[model samples]
Target: MTHGNTSWQEFGQTFVDQSRELNQKVTDEILERTERALVSAKEKIKQTEEVNEILKLRVEKAEQEARDVKALLSRPMREIAEISGDFQKAYEQQQQILANWILSQKAYRETAVQLGIAVGKTAEEVQDLVTQNANAVLENRTEHGNDSNTNPLVKEYASTILAIRKKNGEV
Candidate 1:
Protein backbone atom coordinates (compact mmCIF):
# COMPACT_ATOMS: atom_id res chain seq x y z
CA MET A 1 0.00 0.00 0.00
CA THR A 2 2.83 2.45 0.73
CA HIS A 3 4.56 1.65 -2.57
CA GLY A 4 1.28 2.05 -4.44
CA ASN A 5 0.78 5.46 -2.78
CA THR A 6 4.32 6.57 -3.75
CA SER A 7 3.76 5.46 -7.40
CA TRP A 8 0.43 7.40 -7.53
CA GLN A 9 2.17 10.53 -6.15
CA GLU A 10 4.90 10.29 -8.89
CA PHE A 11 2.24 9.83 -11.56
CA GLY A 12 0.34 12.89 -10.32
CA GLN A 13 3.55 14.98 -10.32
CA THR A 14 4.40 13.91 -13.92
CA PHE A 15 0.86 14.83 -15.05
CA VAL A 16 1.08 18.31 -13.49
CA ASP A 17 4.49 18.92 -15.05
CA GLN A 18 3.24 17.89 -18.53
CA SER A 19 0.17 20.13 -18.13
CA ARG A 20 2.38 23.06 -17.11
CA GLU A 21 4.66 22.52 -20.17
CA LEU A 22 1.62 22.35 -22.52
CA ASN A 23 0.26 25.60 -21.04
CA GLN A 24 3.61 27.32 -21.45
CA LYS A 25 3.93 26.13 -25.08
CA VAL A 26 0.41 27.40 -25.85
CA THR A 27 1.23 30.80 -24.26
CA ASP A 28 4.47 31.08 -26.23
CA GLU A 29 2.69 30.27 -29.55
CA ILE A 30 -0.03 32.86 -28.77
CA LEU A 31 2.58 35.47 -27.95
CA GLU A 32 4.48 34.77 -31.17
CA ARG A 33 1.33 35.04 -33.31
CA THR A 34 0.31 38.24 -31.56
CA GLU A 35 3.75 39.76 -32.19
CA ARG A 36 3.56 38.78 -35.88
CA ALA A 37 0.04 40.29 -36.17
CA LEU A 38 1.28 43.50 -34.51
CA VAL A 39 4.22 43.77 -36.92
CA SER A 40 1.97 43.22 -39.95
CA ALA A 41 -0.49 45.88 -38.68
CA LYS A 42 2.37 48.34 -38.19
CA GLU A 43 3.64 47.74 -41.75
CA LYS A 44 0.12 48.24 -43.13
CA ILE A 45 -0.15 51.49 -41.21
CA LYS A 46 3.13 52.79 -42.63
CA GLN A 47 2.05 51.92 -46.20
CA THR A 48 -1.31 53.60 -45.64
CA GLU A 49 0.42 56.73 -44.36
CA GLU A 50 2.68 56.84 -47.40
CA VAL A 51 -0.30 56.48 -49.74
CA ASN A 52 -2.18 59.16 -47.84
CA GLU A 53 0.72 61.59 -48.15
CA ILE A 54 1.00 60.97 -51.86
CA LEU A 55 -2.75 61.52 -52.30
CA LYS A 56 -2.56 64.74 -50.34
CA LEU A 57 0.25 66.08 -52.55
CA ARG A 58 -1.66 65.14 -55.69
CA VAL A 59 -4.76 66.90 -54.43
CA GLU A 60 -2.79 70.03 -53.66
CA LYS A 61 -1.23 70.05 -57.13
CA ALA A 62 -4.64 69.62 -58.75
CA GLU A 63 -6.06 72.48 -56.72
CA GLN A 64 -3.20 74.77 -57.71
CA GLU A 65 -3.69 73.88 -61.39
CA ALA A 66 -7.36 74.71 -61.09
CA ARG A 67 -6.53 78.06 -59.59
CA ASP A 68 -4.02 78.76 -62.35
CA VAL A 69 -6.55 77.86 -65.04
CA LYS A 70 -9.15 80.11 -63.48
CA ALA A 71 -6.67 82.99 -63.38
CA LEU A 72 -5.66 82.40 -67.00
CA LEU A 73 -9.27 82.51 -68.12
CA SER A 74 -9.92 85.74 -66.23
CA ARG A 75 -6.65 87.36 -67.31
CA PRO A 76 -7.65 87.47 -70.98
CA MET A 77 -11.01 88.95 -70.06
CA ARG A 78 -9.28 91.63 -68.02
CA GLU A 79 -6.88 92.45 -70.86
CA ILE A 80 -9.70 92.56 -73.41
CA ALA A 81 -11.74 94.87 -71.16
CA GLU A 82 -8.76 97.20 -70.81
CA ILE A 83 -8.14 97.13 -74.57
CA SER A 84 -11.84 97.85 -75.24
CA GLY A 85 -11.57 101.19 -73.46
CA ASP A 86 -8.43 102.02 -75.39
CA PHE A 87 -10.14 101.15 -78.70
CA GLN A 88 -13.07 103.42 -77.79
CA LYS A 89 -10.72 106.31 -77.04
CA ALA A 90 -8.86 105.73 -80.30
CA TYR A 91 -12.17 105.66 -82.22
CA GLU A 92 -13.28 108.95 -80.67
CA GLN A 93 -9.98 110.60 -81.53
CA GLN A 94 -10.24 109.34 -85.12
CA GLN A 95 -13.78 110.72 -85.41
CA GLN A 96 -12.65 114.16 -84.24
CA ILE A 97 -9.79 114.14 -86.74
CA LEU A 98 -12.17 113.24 -89.59
CA ALA A 99 -14.55 116.04 -88.58
CA ASN A 100 -11.72 118.57 -88.56
CA TRP A 101 -10.59 117.30 -91.96
CA ILE A 102 -14.09 117.73 -93.44
CA LEU A 103 -14.36 121.28 -92.12
CA SER A 104 -10.97 122.20 -93.52
CA GLN A 105 -11.83 120.71 -96.91
CA LYS A 106 -15.13 122.62 -97.02
CA ALA A 107 -13.37 125.87 -96.17
CA TYR A 108 -10.71 125.16 -98.78
CA ARG A 109 -13.31 124.53 -101.50
CA GLU A 110 -15.20 127.72 -100.64
CA THR A 111 -12.01 129.77 -100.85
CA ALA A 112 -11.10 128.23 -104.21
CA VAL A 113 -14.52 128.92 -105.74
CA GLN A 114 -14.52 132.54 -104.56
CA LEU A 115 -10.82 133.37 -105.14
CA GLY A 116 -10.34 136.24 -107.63
CA ILE A 117 -11.37 137.44 -111.02
CA ALA A 118 -9.96 140.88 -110.11
CA VAL A 119 -6.46 139.37 -109.79
CA GLY A 120 -6.40 138.78 -113.58
CA LYS A 121 -7.06 135.07 -113.21
CA THR A 122 -9.72 133.13 -115.12
CA ALA A 123 -11.75 130.60 -113.12
CA GLU A 124 -10.10 127.69 -114.89
CA GLU A 125 -6.59 128.98 -114.04
CA VAL A 126 -7.57 129.51 -110.42
CA GLN A 127 -9.01 125.96 -110.20
CA ASP A 128 -5.82 124.44 -111.63
CA LEU A 129 -3.64 126.36 -109.15
CA VAL A 130 -5.81 125.24 -106.24
CA THR A 131 -5.66 121.60 -107.36
CA GLN A 132 -1.84 121.69 -107.64
CA ASN A 133 -1.50 123.27 -104.18
CA ALA A 134 -3.77 120.58 -102.67
CA ASN A 135 -1.68 117.84 -104.31
CA ALA A 136 1.53 119.33 -102.80
CA VAL A 137 0.05 119.41 -99.25
CA LEU A 138 -1.17 115.81 -99.60
CA GLU A 139 2.17 114.56 -100.86
CA ASN A 140 4.01 116.14 -97.93
CA ARG A 141 1.56 114.66 -95.39
CA THR A 142 0.86 111.20 -96.88
CA GLU A 143 2.93 107.93 -96.78
CA HIS A 144 6.25 109.75 -96.63
CA GLY A 145 5.12 112.30 -93.98
CA ASN A 146 6.26 115.94 -93.55
CA ASP A 147 10.01 115.26 -93.49
CA SER A 148 10.09 113.09 -96.62
CA ASN A 149 11.50 114.05 -100.00
CA THR A 150 8.91 116.49 -101.34
CA ASN A 151 8.52 117.26 -105.07
CA PRO A 152 10.28 120.61 -105.79
CA LEU A 153 7.77 121.64 -108.45
CA VAL A 154 4.81 120.94 -106.16
CA LYS A 155 6.41 122.81 -103.24
CA GLU A 156 7.16 125.83 -105.46
CA TYR A 157 3.64 125.71 -106.88
CA ALA A 158 2.16 125.59 -103.33
CA SER A 159 4.38 128.56 -102.35
CA THR A 160 3.19 130.53 -105.39
CA ILE A 161 -0.45 129.81 -104.54
CA LEU A 162 0.05 130.94 -100.95
CA ALA A 163 1.74 134.18 -102.13
CA ILE A 164 -1.08 134.86 -104.54
CA ARG A 165 -3.74 134.23 -101.90
CA LYS A 166 -1.95 136.48 -99.42
CA LYS A 167 -1.43 139.24 -101.99
CA ASN A 168 -5.07 139.20 -103.07
CA GLY A 169 -6.38 139.35 -99.48
CA GLU A 170 -7.81 135.82 -100.05
CA VAL A 171 -5.63 134.01 -97.51
Candidate 2:
Protein backbone atom coordinates (compact mmCIF):
# COMPACT_ATOMS: atom_id res chain seq x y z
CA MET A 1 0.00 0.00 0.00
CA THR A 2 2.84 2.45 0.76
CA HIS A 3 4.53 1.84 -2.61
CA GLY A 4 1.25 2.36 -4.51
CA ASN A 5 0.67 5.72 -2.69
CA THR A 6 4.23 6.85 -3.49
CA SER A 7 3.75 6.02 -7.22
CA TRP A 8 0.47 8.05 -7.41
CA GLN A 9 2.04 11.10 -5.73
CA GLU A 10 4.97 11.06 -8.17
CA PHE A 11 2.62 10.94 -11.20
CA GLY A 12 0.59 13.94 -9.90
CA GLN A 13 3.72 16.05 -9.44
CA THR A 14 4.95 15.29 -12.96
CA PHE A 15 1.62 16.32 -14.49
CA VAL A 16 1.60 19.68 -12.62
CA ASP A 17 5.14 20.52 -13.80
CA GLN A 18 4.30 19.70 -17.40
CA SER A 19 1.15 21.91 -17.29
CA ARG A 20 3.11 24.90 -15.86
CA GLU A 21 5.83 24.63 -18.59
CA LEU A 22 3.14 24.54 -21.38
CA ASN A 23 1.41 27.63 -19.95
CA GLN A 24 4.71 29.55 -19.80
CA LYS A 25 5.48 28.75 -23.47
CA VAL A 26 2.09 29.95 -24.57
CA THR A 27 2.48 33.25 -22.60
CA ASP A 28 5.90 33.92 -24.17
CA GLU A 29 4.56 33.39 -27.72
CA ILE A 30 1.64 35.73 -27.09
CA LEU A 31 3.90 38.46 -25.72
CA GLU A 32 6.24 38.28 -28.74
CA ARG A 33 3.33 38.46 -31.23
CA THR A 34 1.85 41.48 -29.38
CA GLU A 35 5.15 43.37 -29.56
CA ARG A 36 5.52 42.70 -33.30
CA ALA A 37 1.99 43.97 -33.95
CA LEU A 38 2.66 47.17 -31.99
CA VAL A 39 5.83 47.86 -34.01
CA SER A 40 3.94 47.39 -37.30
CA ALA A 41 1.20 49.78 -36.25
CA LYS A 42 3.73 52.46 -35.28
CA GLU A 43 5.52 52.12 -38.64
CA LYS A 44 2.25 52.56 -40.52
CA ILE A 45 1.46 55.71 -38.49
CA LYS A 46 4.89 57.20 -39.25
CA GLN A 47 4.50 56.52 -42.95
CA THR A 48 1.09 58.23 -42.94
CA GLU A 49 2.53 61.32 -41.26
CA GLU A 50 5.33 61.59 -43.80
CA VAL A 51 2.88 61.32 -46.67
CA ASN A 52 0.67 64.02 -45.13
CA GLU A 53 3.61 66.44 -44.86
CA ILE A 54 4.60 65.89 -48.45
CA LEU A 55 1.04 66.54 -49.64
CA LYS A 56 0.84 69.73 -47.60
CA LEU A 57 3.99 71.10 -49.21
CA ARG A 58 2.74 70.28 -52.67
CA VAL A 59 -0.53 72.08 -52.01
CA GLU A 60 1.27 75.19 -50.80
CA LYS A 61 3.48 75.25 -53.87
CA ALA A 62 0.48 74.89 -56.14
CA GLU A 63 -1.30 77.82 -54.48
CA GLN A 64 1.72 80.09 -54.93
CA GLU A 65 2.04 79.10 -58.56
CA ALA A 66 -1.62 79.84 -59.10
CA ARG A 67 -1.19 83.35 -57.70
CA ASP A 68 1.79 83.98 -59.97
CA VAL A 69 -0.17 82.88 -63.00
CA LYS A 70 -3.05 85.18 -62.07
CA ALA A 71 -0.72 88.17 -61.83
CA LEU A 72 0.89 87.33 -65.15
CA LEU A 73 -2.44 86.95 -66.91
CA SER A 74 -3.78 90.30 -65.67
CA ARG A 75 -0.70 92.38 -66.54
CA PRO A 76 -1.91 93.44 -70.00
CA MET A 77 -5.27 94.56 -68.62
CA ARG A 78 -3.63 96.74 -65.97
CA GLU A 79 -1.40 98.41 -68.56
CA ILE A 80 -4.35 99.11 -70.82
CA ALA A 81 -6.31 100.61 -67.94
CA GLU A 82 -3.47 103.02 -67.17
CA ILE A 83 -3.34 104.10 -70.81
CA SER A 84 -7.07 104.70 -70.84
CA GLY A 85 -6.80 106.90 -67.77
CA ASP A 86 -4.15 109.01 -69.48
CA PHE A 87 -6.31 109.48 -72.54
CA GLN A 88 -9.24 110.47 -70.39
CA LYS A 89 -7.20 113.09 -68.64
CA ALA A 90 -6.01 114.54 -71.95
CA TYR A 91 -9.54 114.66 -73.35
CA GLU A 92 -10.85 116.50 -70.31
CA GLN A 93 -8.07 119.04 -70.51
CA GLN A 94 -8.71 119.61 -74.21
CA GLN A 95 -12.39 120.17 -73.58
CA GLN A 96 -11.60 122.82 -70.98
CA ILE A 97 -9.33 124.60 -73.48
CA LEU A 98 -12.02 124.51 -76.16
CA ALA A 99 -14.50 126.04 -73.78
CA ASN A 100 -12.12 128.89 -73.02
CA TRP A 101 -11.47 129.55 -76.72
CA ILE A 102 -15.18 129.66 -77.56
CA LEU A 103 -15.67 132.40 -74.95
CA SER A 104 -13.11 134.61 -76.80
CA GLN A 105 -14.22 134.34 -80.44
CA LYS A 106 -13.86 137.34 -82.79
CA ALA A 107 -15.89 138.04 -85.97
CA TYR A 108 -13.49 138.72 -88.86
CA ARG A 109 -14.16 140.61 -92.14
CA GLU A 110 -15.05 138.56 -95.24
CA THR A 111 -11.98 139.77 -97.18
CA ALA A 112 -9.97 136.45 -97.06
CA VAL A 113 -6.53 138.05 -97.38
CA GLN A 114 -4.28 137.56 -94.40
CA LEU A 115 -1.42 139.97 -93.83
CA GLY A 116 0.79 137.13 -92.43
CA ILE A 117 0.52 133.42 -93.14
CA ALA A 118 2.61 130.67 -91.62
CA VAL A 119 4.13 128.55 -94.44
CA GLY A 120 0.90 126.88 -95.69
CA LYS A 121 -1.62 127.14 -92.81
CA THR A 122 -4.27 129.87 -92.37
CA ALA A 123 -6.34 130.83 -89.34
CA GLU A 124 -9.32 128.93 -90.80
CA GLU A 125 -7.48 125.58 -90.30
CA VAL A 126 -8.62 125.19 -86.68
CA GLN A 127 -9.95 121.67 -87.02
CA ASP A 128 -6.79 120.24 -88.57
CA LEU A 129 -4.60 122.17 -86.17
CA VAL A 130 -6.59 120.92 -83.19
CA THR A 131 -6.12 117.27 -84.24
CA GLN A 132 -2.43 117.63 -85.08
CA ASN A 133 -1.65 119.50 -81.89
CA ALA A 134 -3.60 117.10 -79.72
CA ASN A 135 -1.70 114.16 -81.20
CA ALA A 136 1.61 115.93 -80.68
CA VAL A 137 0.69 116.63 -77.10
CA LEU A 138 -0.26 113.01 -76.46
CA GLU A 139 2.96 111.77 -78.06
CA ASN A 140 4.99 114.09 -75.90
CA ARG A 141 3.16 113.08 -72.77
CA THR A 142 3.88 109.39 -73.40
CA GLU A 143 7.42 109.75 -74.63
CA HIS A 144 8.47 106.54 -72.94
CA GLY A 145 5.55 104.52 -74.20
CA ASN A 146 5.59 101.96 -77.01
CA ASP A 147 5.26 104.33 -79.98
CA SER A 148 5.43 101.90 -82.87
CA ASN A 149 2.14 102.76 -84.59
CA THR A 150 2.63 99.85 -86.96
CA ASN A 151 3.16 97.19 -84.32
CA PRO A 152 0.56 94.50 -85.03
CA LEU A 153 0.58 93.12 -81.51
CA VAL A 154 -0.03 96.53 -79.95
CA LYS A 155 -2.76 97.35 -82.46
CA GLU A 156 -4.53 94.02 -81.96
CA TYR A 157 -4.41 94.24 -78.19
CA ALA A 158 -5.72 97.77 -78.17
CA SER A 159 -8.48 97.05 -80.66
CA THR A 160 -9.59 94.00 -78.74
CA ILE A 161 -9.67 95.84 -75.43
CA LEU A 162 -11.55 98.77 -76.89
CA ALA A 163 -14.04 96.53 -78.62
CA ILE A 164 -14.69 94.60 -75.46
CA ARG A 165 -15.19 97.79 -73.51
CA LYS A 166 -17.55 99.10 -76.16
CA LYS A 167 -19.54 95.90 -76.12
CA ASN A 168 -19.78 96.04 -72.36
CA GLY A 169 -20.85 99.72 -72.40
CA GLU A 170 -17.70 100.75 -70.61
CA VAL A 171 -16.32 102.90 -73.46
Candidate 3:
Protein backbone atom coordinates (compact mmCIF):
# COMPACT_ATOMS: atom_id res chain seq x y z
CA MET A 1 0.00 0.00 0.00
CA THR A 2 2.95 2.39 0.70
CA HIS A 3 4.46 1.83 -2.82
CA GLY A 4 1.06 2.45 -4.49
CA ASN A 5 0.59 5.70 -2.55
CA THR A 6 4.04 6.98 -3.65
CA SER A 7 3.24 6.27 -7.38
CA TRP A 8 -0.10 8.13 -7.10
CA GLN A 9 1.60 11.19 -5.59
CA GLU A 10 4.14 11.28 -8.49
CA PHE A 11 1.31 11.18 -11.09
CA GLY A 12 -0.49 14.11 -9.45
CA GLN A 13 2.71 16.26 -9.48
CA THR A 14 3.31 15.49 -13.18
CA PHE A 15 -0.23 16.57 -14.09
CA VAL A 16 0.12 19.95 -12.33
CA ASP A 17 3.50 20.66 -13.99
CA GLN A 18 2.04 19.90 -17.49
CA SER A 19 -0.88 22.26 -16.90
CA ARG A 20 1.42 25.14 -15.82
CA GLU A 21 3.63 24.69 -18.91
CA LEU A 22 0.63 24.74 -21.28
CA ASN A 23 -0.74 27.93 -19.71
CA GLN A 24 2.59 29.77 -20.17
CA LYS A 25 2.80 28.82 -23.89
CA VAL A 26 -0.77 30.01 -24.59
CA THR A 27 -0.19 33.37 -22.84
CA ASP A 28 3.03 34.07 -24.80
CA GLU A 29 1.35 33.35 -28.16
CA ILE A 30 -1.59 35.63 -27.35
CA LEU A 31 0.76 38.52 -26.42
CA GLU A 32 2.81 38.17 -29.64
CA ARG A 33 -0.33 38.20 -31.87
CA THR A 34 -1.70 41.25 -30.04
CA GLU A 35 1.51 43.23 -30.62
CA ARG A 36 1.50 42.35 -34.35
CA ALA A 37 -2.11 43.51 -34.70
CA LEU A 38 -1.34 46.85 -33.00
CA VAL A 39 1.60 47.56 -35.35
CA SER A 40 -0.55 46.77 -38.42
CA ALA A 41 -3.28 49.15 -37.18
CA LYS A 42 -0.78 52.02 -36.73
CA GLU A 43 0.61 51.53 -40.27
CA LYS A 44 -2.91 51.66 -41.72
CA ILE A 45 -3.61 54.92 -39.88
CA LYS A 46 -0.43 56.55 -41.23
CA GLN A 47 -1.41 55.63 -44.83
CA THR A 48 -4.89 57.07 -44.30
CA GLU A 49 -3.41 60.40 -43.04
CA GLU A 50 -1.14 60.76 -46.11
CA VAL A 51 -4.05 60.10 -48.49
CA ASN A 52 -6.20 62.71 -46.70
CA GLU A 53 -3.57 65.47 -47.23
CA ILE A 54 -3.32 64.74 -50.99
CA LEU A 55 -7.11 64.89 -51.31
CA LYS A 56 -7.11 68.41 -49.77
CA LEU A 57 -4.50 69.71 -52.26
CA ARG A 58 -6.46 68.20 -55.15
CA VAL A 59 -9.63 69.97 -54.03
CA GLU A 60 -7.87 73.36 -53.74
CA LYS A 61 -6.30 73.07 -57.21
CA ALA A 62 -9.67 72.08 -58.74
CA GLU A 63 -11.37 75.13 -57.18
CA GLN A 64 -8.71 77.52 -58.54
CA GLU A 65 -8.93 76.04 -62.05
CA ALA A 66 -12.73 76.40 -62.01
CA ARG A 67 -12.46 80.09 -61.06
CA ASP A 68 -9.97 80.72 -63.87
CA VAL A 69 -12.23 79.01 -66.42
CA LYS A 70 -15.24 81.03 -65.29
CA ALA A 71 -13.36 84.33 -65.61
CA LEU A 72 -12.12 83.45 -69.12
CA LEU A 73 -15.63 82.48 -70.27
CA SER A 74 -17.21 85.70 -68.96
CA ARG A 75 -15.19 87.96 -71.28
CA PRO A 76 -16.45 88.83 -74.82
CA MET A 77 -14.77 86.71 -77.51
CA ARG A 78 -13.58 89.66 -79.63
CA GLU A 79 -12.38 91.60 -76.58
CA ILE A 80 -10.44 88.63 -75.35
CA ALA A 81 -8.78 88.10 -78.73
CA GLU A 82 -7.87 91.78 -79.06
CA ILE A 83 -6.57 91.91 -75.51
CA SER A 84 -4.42 88.83 -76.13
CA GLY A 85 -3.05 90.15 -79.44
CA ASP A 86 -2.26 93.58 -77.96
CA PHE A 87 -0.62 91.96 -74.95
CA GLN A 88 1.79 90.03 -77.21
CA LYS A 89 2.70 93.17 -79.18
CA ALA A 90 3.07 95.22 -76.01
CA TYR A 91 5.31 92.57 -74.46
CA GLU A 92 7.61 92.58 -77.50
CA GLN A 93 7.73 96.39 -77.54
CA GLN A 94 8.48 96.41 -73.79
CA GLN A 95 11.42 94.04 -74.31
CA GLN A 96 12.98 96.30 -76.97
CA ILE A 97 12.35 99.39 -74.85
CA LEU A 98 14.00 97.81 -71.83
CA ALA A 99 17.06 96.86 -73.84
CA ASN A 100 17.46 100.33 -75.31
CA TRP A 101 16.91 101.97 -71.93
CA ILE A 102 19.52 99.80 -70.28
CA LEU A 103 22.09 100.63 -72.98
CA SER A 104 21.43 104.37 -72.70
CA GLN A 105 21.69 104.28 -68.89
CA LYS A 106 24.98 102.39 -69.15
CA ALA A 107 26.38 105.11 -71.41
CA TYR A 108 25.13 107.86 -69.08
CA ARG A 109 26.59 106.21 -65.97
CA GLU A 110 29.93 105.76 -67.71
CA THR A 111 29.98 109.38 -68.80
CA ALA A 112 29.18 110.60 -65.28
CA VAL A 113 31.93 108.41 -63.83
CA GLN A 114 34.46 109.82 -66.31
CA LEU A 115 33.43 113.38 -65.51
CA GLY A 116 33.70 112.70 -61.77
CA ILE A 117 37.20 111.26 -62.18
CA ALA A 118 38.23 114.27 -64.20
CA VAL A 119 37.11 116.50 -61.28
CA GLY A 120 39.19 114.40 -58.78
CA LYS A 121 35.99 113.05 -57.10
CA THR A 122 35.85 109.68 -55.38
CA ALA A 123 33.95 106.62 -56.78
CA GLU A 124 31.40 106.93 -53.94
CA GLU A 125 30.62 110.50 -55.06
CA VAL A 126 29.97 109.29 -58.59
CA GLN A 127 27.61 106.56 -57.32
CA ASP A 128 25.77 109.07 -55.10
CA LEU A 129 25.15 111.31 -58.11
CA VAL A 130 23.72 108.37 -60.07
CA THR A 131 21.40 107.41 -57.21
CA GLN A 132 20.24 110.98 -56.74
CA ASN A 133 19.50 111.28 -60.46
CA ALA A 134 17.46 108.05 -60.38
CA ASN A 135 15.38 109.22 -57.40
CA ALA A 136 14.80 112.67 -58.92
CA VAL A 137 13.60 111.03 -62.13
CA LEU A 138 11.08 108.91 -60.23
CA GLU A 139 9.81 111.91 -58.27
CA ASN A 140 9.53 114.12 -61.36
CA ARG A 141 7.33 111.55 -63.14
CA THR A 142 4.97 111.46 -60.14
CA GLU A 143 4.61 115.24 -60.33
CA HIS A 144 4.00 115.38 -64.11
CA GLY A 145 0.98 113.01 -64.28
CA ASN A 146 2.28 111.49 -67.56
CA ASP A 147 2.29 107.85 -66.55
CA SER A 148 1.45 105.39 -69.40
CA ASN A 149 2.63 101.97 -68.16
CA THR A 150 1.80 100.13 -64.91
CA ASN A 151 5.49 99.59 -64.06
CA PRO A 152 6.94 102.32 -61.87
CA LEU A 153 10.44 101.54 -63.13
CA VAL A 154 9.47 102.24 -66.73
CA LYS A 155 7.96 105.57 -65.73
CA GLU A 156 11.01 106.41 -63.66
CA TYR A 157 13.46 105.46 -66.41
CA ALA A 158 11.53 107.49 -68.99
CA SER A 159 11.58 110.42 -66.57
CA THR A 160 15.33 109.99 -66.14
CA ILE A 161 15.90 110.29 -69.90
CA LEU A 162 13.81 113.43 -70.05
CA ALA A 163 15.58 114.89 -67.02
CA ILE A 164 19.00 114.19 -68.52
CA ARG A 165 18.02 115.71 -71.87
CA LYS A 166 16.64 118.78 -70.09
CA LYS A 167 19.82 119.17 -68.03
CA ASN A 168 21.95 119.00 -71.20
CA GLY A 169 19.82 121.68 -72.99
CA GLU A 170 18.46 119.07 -75.45
CA VAL A 171 14.86 118.82 -74.17
Query: Pick by TM-score: which candidate is best?
Result: 1
Please, what are the lDDT tens digits per residue for candidate 2 over residues 1-171? 245557767777778888889989999999999999999999999999999999999999999999986775567644544556765576667668877766553222212224224345565664444434434433333344544244565455655554564577543
Candidate 1 residue lDDT tens string, 60-154: 99999999767755665445445567656766676788899899988977676676465777878877766555554644554335322365655
Where is model 1 more than 4 Å wrong at Cα? 1-6, 77-171
Arranged by lDDT with the best first, the candidates are 3, 1, 2
Q: Give one clash count per candidate, in the order shown.
A: 0, 0, 0
Relative to the true structure, how large is the alpha-carbon lDDT of every model? 0.72, 0.62, 0.74
Error of 1 at 64 (Å): 0.8
**Cα error, candidate 1, residue 128 (Å):** 37
lDDT digits (tens) for residues 132-168 of candidate 3: 5655544554345534244666665776676775687
TM-score, predicted candidate 1 vs. hidden true structure: 0.42
115: Cα error in model 1, Å: 34
Off by more than 4 A, model 2: 1-6, 77-171
RMSD of each: 16.3, 13.3, 16.5
